[model samples]
Target: MALLINHCPVRWHAIYHSHWTALQYDQQSITYQQLDQLLSALQRQLLTQINLTTPPSMVRLACIASNGIELLLMQLLCVRVGWLFCPLNPRFTATELSQRLAVLNTPYCWIENEQDADSLPTSSPQLQIDFELLLSNLHEQASSSIAVTTNISTSAITLTPLLIEPEQACNIIFTSGSSGFPKAIVHNYRNHFFSALGSQRLIPLASQDHNLLSLPLFHIGGYATVLRTVIAGACIHLTTYPLTVALLQQHRITHLSLVSTQLIRLLADPLFNAKQSAIKHVLLGGSAFSEEHLTALAARGFHYHLSYGSTEMASQIATSDNSSQLQVLPYREIKTHRGEIYITGETRFIGYFRDNAIHKIAAEEWVASGDLGTLKQHKLSIIGRKDRQFISGGENIQPEEIERVCLQYGRVKQAYICPTKDQQYGQRIALFVLFSDSTQFDLDCQQLKHYLGQKLISFKQPDHYLAWPLKLANNQALKVPKQVFLDSLSKQGLT
Candidate 1:
């Protein structure tokens, strides 16, 4: 029988997998036994600070760090004390971070290093905490605890458990908000519990598995990995390193997750040998999978699970295990109402946070997912997001439809179609193509337009073609900044 994830999986792991490897970073590994002691010390530090200022329940914490040991430790410690943990992307500029933190409403952020401290928004209201200082204290505690723990190998260390109810907010995950402004998704431990249990149905995990931290902790994909690892009592391989074939082989990773773009980078690498690797499963999400990429995955014999999800739904709403057909996870109920997806489940987030208040998304039968998908054979196939669909020349045009056609070709590596103003058509499709063999292939406008004409309808064809920017060459992340594309088009007098 599979482990039905409870609200307190961390505690369950502590009791059962005490001597098992719980976490690993660059030359650092922590067992569940050591983790219990570290959690105890951190708990005291957390309570010490809270008791000096306010009640533990009232104090919330956020983390601003790149992927590392400190960030992971704090994530566990925050939950142990029932303090909500908000993870911020290190790539965000001070301006971007400020805008997000303003919406998140000052939750005492923990900076990973002095460099991050310097990058803080000048003249912001958010309180900053020193992660290095806390690490120093933890080291001191570890020194004393190791000797005491060496003798008592077969026992459990008593931990101060948090009073975390099912509905209590435990995390705040900010979305990419590709449609609009990023949303601060408020989530409880119950949400993570359900999300983990549901995803396990598609990608079954075991206690002996080692899952790599492939995605950033700030994103829901990365956050979900952490949840799944803890619930399964599996070990997590942490790294500041990028996701590479060498890294996977070196660590002997049993499972990992990736975005389509990230996965493409690994597949494109000539050194990557799929047959020789120890990895058993790859959970792919973030964006749509192209036909070419899918073919490559199949050829390499990679066991991959495709998923469709959002931050508001914790992680995945629907998933497929190494197949084209997608089915909803065990915990969530999904339905299509007028071409848009609606979901209702235990995995649903509490709400969005802004202006020192909670803007809750009511679960009245279902929550509108802003995505359009069709169900055939009792399986879901996504067309696109409802918000991404736009009209062109009196016909409903989905950019993804055009993009899908473009990606079906042999040479094209990336496809992005945006709406540009057109007086005659009301709005026209602006296509941007990035070729795989840039040196051998000709990217002339007339040549590519003629190529697209053969595969697409007249109305569905892009009115304008964008010159691939040289700056984005060989970049792993396929997304080109919108403004960059628009600005380049204007300079060429195309818009």
Candidate 2:
């Protein structure tokens, strides 16, 4: 591992020597020098394509793509130029894309290619930049660019001063929006810098470690991985989707991040024997984790970290090594008021993007994270989302509590409990269970009722039970929208 400064005014990538590997994709590997040249070329091509109405600080360089080298380079280019790099979910529908683009106000967007054009509106402007040609042209000029960069002293070279300032807006990532329209969360260079720094302290990464780009680039976890890898001078592997055990073994990945669902699927993989793998640390986030899965990982001698974070806080606010409670990482502060978590820190986002500009969040203001929790002895334990709590039969019900109990059931793989209208009780609990075995579809409701009868009190028990809607879960989004299940139940006159 090389000695590298974590935070500075200049581009973080420039901190590492030219020979260090920055990115890896199957047979190809790119060094810091090569990536720098690619980023410069991307910046030149992007400027010629965009038509901005605001200053560079306000300009949003919108892109729709999956986790890949191009998207990673685009974000680095945005940081270099002070543009707000907004990455939209490529799986978004035409309508979903249009709604978000209306808020973005950028004249044009960069799409993957012609095939992706249909997802955008007919009137929406788009630029299909030829990355292959851009890379080829760079190869022709690689010698000169490499020589020019290497000849200059590190202190003499710097990204645009005003544009790359720590306070300048750097990225706009949308919330998962599991039930409704997503909010555009804004983050500055400082937010990401400290986030990467804090994360490295908890989950140490070195130049020799290979960090898997497991999550989508549109996600905060994914984007944070890019910065963490660069700041630590580590290598990032851009692996293929439906990530298999074979792929993990082939890459010899040391560090990775995953949602609970992805972790469960990987554990279920026949080829996965956690004890034999090279994986050193796994950062688990997104949803409530299953104890059964954790126990399985423990039985297999796998190492994992449970983290709690949001889009508003860059990525990780707190993470746990082996304990149930999360330990607050460096550069972030957390407190509980009336059982709801409030956070104010360097990693706290700039604000929510709206009306073509960020509605800035003052540095002194402590943002209320809608999550309810308890802070004791400097450790945080999450209860559940305040918004997810509902009143049924005049008794308050926290869906996560019931969902956790359902997950404990051996046959249940994923459990989601949502509230639906009930004439007798105003609102009633509805359980959607994704079973581990397909044969569970024939499960008798009475048997589940008996099981719940033992685990839950009468009031917390679910009124209706249904098998998980497979079609609704078959999306690119990390978590399935809970509203989708409620709607399906509504169609069946169960609401």
| Top TM-score model | 2
Model 1 over residues 403-485: C-alpha lDDT tens digits?
87887876777777878878898888888777766664445556667878998889999977665777655544423355667
Clashing pairs in 2: none
Candidate 1 TM-score over all chains jointly: 0.89
lDDT of residue 198 for candidate 1: 86
Q: Give all TM-scores, in the order shown.
A: 0.89, 0.90
lDDT of 2 by residue, 1-495 (tens): 333332332234444455667788776777765676677777778778665555888777788888787888888778777788899888778888888888887776888766878756757677657789766754555457666455434422653222346788888898988636899999988898889888887799987899998888898988888888877778999966567788888888889888766777788786676666788888888777778887777667767788999888899999998555699899899999998999989999989899877899789899998898888776888888898999998998988889888877766777888888888999998888777676747564566678989989999999888878877543435566777787789887887
**Candidate 1 backbone collisions, by pair:** none
User: Candidate 2 lDDT (Cα, whole model)?
Assistant: 0.78
**Which regions of candidate 1 fall more than 4 Å away from where they truly are?**
1-7, 51-58, 115-163, 441-451, 474-481
